[model samples]
Target: MHKSRTNFVFGEGDKNASLLLIGEAPGAQEDLEGRPFVGRSGKLLDKILKAIDRDRFNDTYICNILKCRPPENRNPSLSEIDECKPYLNHQIKLINPKLIVTLGLVAASTLLGKDSSLKDMRNNIFYYMNYPVLVTYHPAFLLRSPSFKRNAWEDFKRIRDYIKD
Candidate 1:
């Protein structure tokens, strides 16, 4: 997979941050730039962070479950997730964030190790490696279904409150 990928979009932001945001995978723009969350979804994510008084550059770390983009922006296969999880795990170990915000179903499921609907996961906090994890809609999903923005905002508020503690 790495052999076919243009670049490995590991992550970006404060290395010592106490907040970590995990997304599903990189998109075309992210792949091209060799960075995570640089496209439209990323732009919305920046807004979400700003609303919470957080920014990737200073207070939070951002990363994806898969280091590389899947073909056609498809959902990552179980095998692909299995292969890439260790890298994400290592990142968590290194960052040791006090709070983790999963940006989509894929991220929430992968980090939580459970298969469930996004609705089932949202508005709740789960534990991943003992770190508090909050599940929310992916920015891409919110872009497509603006109705869910309210829900996503609710999740972000939980994150903001958690970090404030």
Candidate 2:
């Protein structure tokens, strides 16, 4: 399904970062640039991180659940997610971050292994491979639903509270 993808988008940031952020998949800008979260959503993410006094490149590592862009930028199917799981898992193992944050439903469900609503997942800490995991609205979702920015801010604050530096 991702055969036409231009880049693998294997992810980027400090390998030793204590924070690992996972999104659903690469979008158009991310695919073209071969970097995760480099589009409008990324810009918003930067602001979000800045609000909590975090930096994308220097502080937290960022990547997507699926490294490649799905066709038509559509949601990734189950088979595709299954195929990409190993790579993401390896990343998690290598990063060994103290905290893991899933930015959307796909990523959260992938880690938590449940189909709960983002609403249900928020403010709750789940575990992935012994690391604490948090779930929040994707930057894309926050952009579309500005009202939820408050909720996202709360989630980010939770992160800020944990990684006090």
TM of each candidate vs. truth:
0.96, 0.97
Model 1 Cα shift for residue 38 (angstroms): 0.5
User: Per-residue lDDT of 1-165 in model 2, one digit per residue for the tens?
Assistant: 567899889998889988999999999999999999999999999999888777887768999999999999888999999999999999999999989999999999988999889999888889988999999999999999999998898899999888774
Residue 36 of model 1 has an lDDT of: 91
For model 1 the local lDDT of residue 16 reads: 87
Best by lDDT: 2
RMSD of each: 1.0, 1.1
State in Å the error of residue 69, model 1. 1.0
- Candidate 2 versus truth, CA RMSD in Å, comes to 1.1
Which parts of model 2 are misplaced by more than 4 Å? Answer: none
List the candidate 1 regions with Cα displacement exceeding 4 Å.
Answer: none
lDDT of the structure predicted as candidate 2: 0.91
